[model samples]
Target: MHIDLIRTSSKSLPHQISETLSQRISSGLLQQGVRLPSVRSLATALRVSQVTVSKAYDVLEKRGLIYCRQGKGCFVADPEHTRRQEDGRWQDVYDDYLPRAQLWRNFDYSEVKYPFHIAAIHSELLPLKNIGDSFASLVTQQPELMATYGNFQGDLELRGIMRDHLKTRGIALASSDVMITSGTQQGIDLVARTFVGPGDTVYLEAPSYTGAIDVFAGRGAEMIFVPTDSEGMRVDILTRMCDQRPPKLIYTIPTFQNPSGVTMSIAKRQRLLELARSYRCLIVEDDPFSDLYFHAPPPPTIKSMDSEGHVVYMKSFSKVIAPGCRIACVAAGGNILSRLIAAKSASDLGSPLLTQRAVLPFIAGKYETYAAQLRVTLRGRMEKAAKLLKLYAPPGVKYILPEGGLNLWLELPASPDIGKLHELAEQESISFLPGDVCYSAETPSRHIRLCYSQMNETDMEEGLRLFLRLLGRFLQMGS
Candidate 1:
């Protein structure tokens, strides 16, 4: 390697050198399997100490941008990876967002301390060891389950256990009524495919799950937003919408909804069911966080109150259990179940039987116990986070005390553009989901969602403190 060919400023030698070298390898100027010079030799050529070159190479190797063999010199690593690495420049890979909007789809997580990761309503308090043991047992006893495709309806054992479990939630159904999915998101997609089509009207909560909104729009459904408050989706507005062009489907997260942790009242659930049946519309109820309640016992799902079989209920073990397990269930009513099954069969034969077996222990009786434990733990964490926010929330922000679930929705006092907040947070290594991103409509933006699930009491406090600090600074700068 030529010494003068590589150049960097001594002011920040290691970082500059690393970036320069990363650019070369990533841009293919340095081809894969091309050996890097010896650390001392490169240092001498660049007029830097051996330690600086060594440190740069160390960072490159750790990032998988380059690799070092035992005796062979370090060489450029895979550059064609679809996903970028920790040291990657996301803007180089994906198109950039506008002035102040958050281009979150391009977020790189490795280097971020907290990076305001408030988009996913997931919890880190998952049952790993117990579930892992169950998986091992399945592999040992029912090894054939892995080799064969799962039944279209899912593992019969899991479905049976789930049927009994649903009884406690007041949703009465049999194994035949249920189908396993990759997650609630896929369940929502399958339901969308089953009932909706191009130009079909679909009713959505004003700020619903972004993924669901994307799925519905991707299917070419014309979305109409029904306003939502603390009580959940406005039934009166929905009733009016039904009178007009009745929506083909209504998507809602009734219990402990994402972004806003509002659980619908029983009266609203009944009204929604009535509206669905009256209009002959399908109600796709996502209740993944119903089990993570910290307030009063959660109300019965819309499916339970359905008399006309208009509701399609979906839940996931991903939030409560391990996310990677990819175990989810959906209970369909009317002819929707059959259509969903057909769509699901086309989407993928079925969810894995091994995943089903791994979650059986939870479905049988263990998940309930584990869930109870998690609720208590989460309640404590939520309290801590609330206290921190209440104490340290910067002067132009407002937030509600969530009833249950992993996220906190905040309304910025001055309505700063999301692009500004995203940029500031990105600089601070913090990431968050601005509420506007969740909306499918054009409205004045002033909201953000904070996830408190992954962080402990300390991280929650620190995260909230950092968030308030950043927002306060933004308000001052008026950027």
Candidate 2:
């Protein structure tokens, strides 16, 4: 029997061999009951030490990819054996995971829960009672809205309310410039479709929001990820990129960004806007987390600062208000906005009229008292989570103290295998996002992100303690 020894780098020999062998066995290239070569012979042939070959076999046995008939040798396990062992593995993973993926994929939101939820970000602080009241009043007062299709530009009154409310944040735009979408995910897709055709390039943060990246990827655009530091997107690198191959659009969160919790400095914002103009690229500024800030007032959005009108700004009410409400709005230049609205007409007819109507009263200060109360409620939860993180995190795990936003990025101890941690965390019924998942091609292995916005202090503490416990166990395993 001929077997190809896949070449592996010196550092990853064991893992590479195991992965290669696993694929071979799974594909039925290695038949059941087939005796594999002795570890000593394979090791000498592959120019690796005996230990490396032994480790590969050990892992394959552990994963049930192969079995050792003691004193005989390693042989391929029965294909049925592996299949039976995984009888419901994919289903379990999907039942547990598909909700989050669907939520990210713009699936129906009627039963959606924010993935990795902690329960505090939702029911505790949202003005659900006020929202429910407005929603009922709208449906009762104008039952025709329910019977008829909503306007393509969304509810006129709600757009007017948004136009007026945005003045406080330094964005002055007419209702015509606003096109309400199902959520920011749709807004991003609209922008991607409007400007970026197949093979076009778009620049964004290295470890940026995955949902946005998925949208661009689906549209077949080439993504160029620029690194970000505490101060935010590396403008110098962006400048060089623009000088080389100017991308079709520049996507960013100038305010408190997700995952990293790093807010872009005002100077970087200015440079970014300047770069967009000089390069003549559209800037998709996603500001979903801007309103969640725990610190001083954020700098005005890049769109607000744009004089040439190269920026199309998107904002979501899901994180700050109520996700189930499913409201997001985009403000762009007159030209871009017009094109986006035309596309919106084709995508879903229009945003839900009642949902838009329900948001108007809340934005118009009709529910100011409760809104203020909710802000205080979220701030308290954030502080409590921070305190617990400071208490329980193991040494070498680093994180930025966020001003706003639901999550914090943790740089962990021991360059532990994140896939293993994900498996371990899954076993314990606790979930977290591995750092590599957030990144675009270049994976940063020494990190993970946790969202405190969904959980209360007690749950945050409990979840973190569980994470630390797993980390300790992983370290003990010498991985």
Best by the lDDT measure:
1
Q: Clashes in each model (backbone N, CA, C under 3 Å)?
A: 7, 3
In Å, residue 375's CA in model 2 sits off its true spot by 3.6
Model 1 spans with C-alpha error above 4 angstroms: 1-110, 118-124
- TM-score of each candidate structure, all chains considered together: 0.77, 0.76
lDDT of 2 at 184: 90
Task: Report model 2's TM-score to 2 decimal places.
Answer: 0.76
lDDT of 2 by residue, 168-234 (tens): 7899888888878888988998888778865577888977786777666555455778989989999
Give one digit per residue, the lDDT tens place, for model 1 in 58-141: 988886778877776677775552333446543332421111112324244557677456433334566788888998898999
RMSD of each: 14.6, 9.0
Local accuracy by lDDT, each model: 0.75, 0.71
Q: Which lDDT value does model 2 have at 16?
A: 54
